[model samples]
Target chain A: MYAKEKTGGELSVGGPSVRGMTNAIVVERLVKRFGATTALDGVDLTVAEGSVLGLLGPNGAGKTTVVRVLATLLVADGGRVEVAGLDVGRHADQVRAAIGLTGQYAAVDEYLTGFENLEMVGRLYRLGKRESRKRAGELLERFDLIDAANRPAKTYSGGMRRRLDIAASLINRPRVLFLDEPTTGLDPRSRLAMWEFIAELADGGTTILLTTQYLEEADRLADRMVVIDRGRVIARGTSDELKAQVGGQRLEFTVTDAAVLPRMVERLRPLGVDDPVVDEQARRLSLPVSGGAEVLAEALRLLDGDTSRIFDVGLRRPDLDDVFLALTGRAAEEVASDDDTTAEPAMTGGAR
Target chain B: MSSLAATLSDSVVITKRNLIKVKRVPDLIVFATLSPIMFVLLFRYVFGGAIGGLPPGVSYAEFLLPGIFAQTIVLGSTTTGASIAEDLQKGLIDRFRSLPMARSAVLVGRTVADLGLNAISIVVMGLTGLVVGWRINSSVGEAVTGFLVLLLFAYAVSWLMALVGLLVRTPEVVNNASFIVIFPLTFVANTFVPLESFPSVLRTFAEWNPVSAVVQAARDLFGNTSPLAPVPDAWSLQHPVLYTLIWVVLILAVFVPLSVRGYGRAAGR
Candidate 1:
């Protein structure tokens, strides 16, 4: 029943380079519910082989639910889901063999030494005794944990535990990796280190499905992104395409005085897609515009002599944060505060 | 390797992981060994001469030894539940579940590792019992059989606790919940006292209680029972070995599948 391909009729959403690649993960009309609350509603997504697909959403948007389903940790209520070309429901063990999962919480056993943790995970992955030890040593060195390999994980810092967790996930050298908010609680320095590590993994041709609320992380790592909100897909595209969907670029000018704002707005009016927004207190004027650098040039030409009043002018492209807000109608920071009230241990916390 | 062989290997790996914690955590060693010795000392000195209903030629200390063995082993089984709940709370179970291993390995590994702890506790308690006035009058084979029965009953109880752990999914709650059920289950039976002294209604319940049967079986195997004592009229107490084995088999049959299924759907909450 799982051998037949169901991807034949689906439209390709990625670039030509991604078109020829087989999908490592495929989810069609997925549905998951907890009691009366629908966690995922008819969600559809695919991650091409050796490519990173960012599953972007707010705290409760079911991003973790999608990852859990693909990782074979949670069974979907209604869907045709496949990972590594194996049905998640029927061939869950085969799917697990091909996938690696690093949950939000560092799942390392605190009492075990770092080496023991990795070696245990390797053995569970069916790596033989000698091979498990060898792999544990290799992963500890690779994750820069060799110095602390014999220390219990309870003594390690949060970042070290997270690294150990990720290293344990790579015990089998999984083809598809699911990292659900891998850097959620790390400090800025540790977050940067995690990003570098993830980049290295992505470069090694591992298909990654990364779920994160950090838009900057997605913008940097993902080849394509599927944005979900309130258990449904709201947008799906590359970073630039999603940005473009949020009304293109903005032309902004920091003026010498608030008086020149109206004149500047009139001059840049022809180039903008919408009416100009003027701020009197800050002496700033912004116009939503299209056509990129040429539009800035056109605006500057229209303001030939009036340029003296404008101290700074540039075209600003919409960022993922803006796209997130425009799509979800809630800022990422607000969604984080909302998550604290409904926290459950295993469901939406880390495992799911 | 075949699938069954793979499951056995996987279970051994997980069992090793759990045993490592026992060596590292000082608190666990204290709880496993010290508490049983404390119980024996408290009962032997504090209440040993106070309660007396034993028949001729049988010492209260000898009778209390098998009861202590049963109680300690049963209480020791709670560690399995607490550890499992702790794993679930910290998301370690999620990591294990996502791996390409046998589904039953986690529970099997936990119960088996805990069985090791119970063995260590028995050795400690056995030495402590000898220091008081407890002695095994039976042959070596019968004594070893007595110890085996204690461990087997504890193993079955571990599966029952595993289901509780998966249901509650918190170490603290599992501790409290198991205490509520296990306290009366062990106390109201023949564990700490003879079933003959109980009021007629309580005596009937004690005679059939699984803990009483297990304690009675241990006493019979160790030759702690005196011929002058009243013979149990209840069939379960009369054939204590068979009754205990039946309960062990019945508990394993009901709880093993319940726990595995509960674990699979635990993340759903």
Candidate 2:
């Protein structure tokens, strides 16, 4: 199936018959509970046909559970999931054919070479022998793995293996792709490379649903984002909208000397700097400001003589981490180590 | 018409992938191939003289070859369970479960690949037996039929192993479980010696044993005289063909559905 090129930016791929309902994924009041603990409670989400929706949460926020249900790998205890306009429970085979899944860890066969792995997946999707090999070759080139295609997967680096895994999932040219924590343990460079590839896929009109703990990744790639905690949707909005909910900007300044911290705080007080706190050890003064960059410039002028000697001075806006803390009542960093953090933001569900 | 043809075509592709896996892992082939040859040699050379009561004009190698044929097929089938368990441990099966391919094709393809390996092992063991003075007096068709019977028995055993592989959570547990049951069953049958040599009560059980039937059928088809040929009871006399076919059908009836059910349960569907 192929789409005709249009003047508009939308790059549709599949036939018109498959695009009747433009929503790629729809979950209404989705709830999944593992024994006594509820992993997903009343989670509602809708992904557009050709956009990337990032499901952002800390560990145990049911990101994996949601993906599993959508992929038809695990059945949800309650609520309904629809993929590619087919009911996941009733038409699981249809749903599976329409969606591709790349789990958190690489799932390529270690014994097989990169090319062989892709070819195997291609055959499994029922492509003819010649067509399977052609598709595998194209994927290998696109993923920048052609050179290492003949090497066994076990010999590849972590990044190469992850790339191979993603390539394998796309053998069928699925309409919807699910990536669960795709870059959890990847190096920064490889993570960025993967993000670019994901963005490229979205650009080519593939609906993508991804889960990640990294807020920056969500901000960069997701068209719409949802913050989940303790198996519930705590916040959902565009990046700017979520940041707006957690009001004000951060104004940070570091004095040249430890003794000058008090003076710097006093000089910047009239510039609408609130809650000024001094760290004697690092000789830094930080405060919240309601105004934007202009206020920061004015504050710098007030300390004109010491501006050059200031260790650091900047106005920072609120990010998803702030929204997470404000909504969940705990910093995202603190919750990273707690597995039950997704079960209950409060201290109810004990350590797993 | 086209869609049905496409499905069949896809199944062949899936089957080829499994064959590639079998080829890549030469160690599995080596184990399946060498184990049978070694068993045939050990039984014919080391233990043949120790056991008596072979009919005149029948060398121990001739009598031992058919039993070794059955033994080799059974041993090769155990790898089906081991491979499945290993795949489960490595999360390969879980990955396959998420894919859109035919569900039944996955396990069936694995069994088919294992059956091919079993055939190779059977041929290797047969050649080794010939080198050791074992003669097959039967025609080419009879000899081929003997090998087919052994292969059918191996196919049935593979299904049982597939069920065990799916039910058990760990590879080590599958190994221990299959070995504990298979080793004793092989020993008590006529794999090493004729059933008449056992205690009278044990002889009755061995006569009805599926393993004994397989060995007896192979021995009769290959024209190798067995010590139990003198038994005149209709049930015992008919053991050569009927019992082997019965066991094959029975195993297929039980294990094919058992494995599919186990897969559903393991997937938490």
User: What TM-score, computed on C-alpha atoms, does each candidate reach?
Assistant: 0.87, 0.81
Interface RMSD of candidate 1, in Å, is 0.6
How do the residues B161-196 of candidate 1 rate in per-residue lDDT, one tens digit apiece?
999999888888998988998889999998877777
The numbered model that scores best in lDDT is: 1
Each candidate's DockQ score against the native complex?
0.69, 0.40
Q: What is the C-alpha lDDT of each candidate?
A: 0.85, 0.78
Clashing pairs in 1: none
lDDT of 2 by residue, B28-50 (tens): 77877787888887888799889
Off by over 4 Å in 2: A1-21, A33-38, A243-326, A329-352, B1-7, B200-204, B226-228, B232-237, B264-269
Model 1 DockQ vs. reference: 0.69
lDDT of 1 by residue, A16-41 (tens): 22336687888888999988999999
Residues A192-304 of candidate 2 have per-residue lDDT tens digits of 89989988998999999999876677878888777788788877666666677666677877667788887788888887546676778878776778766788778878887
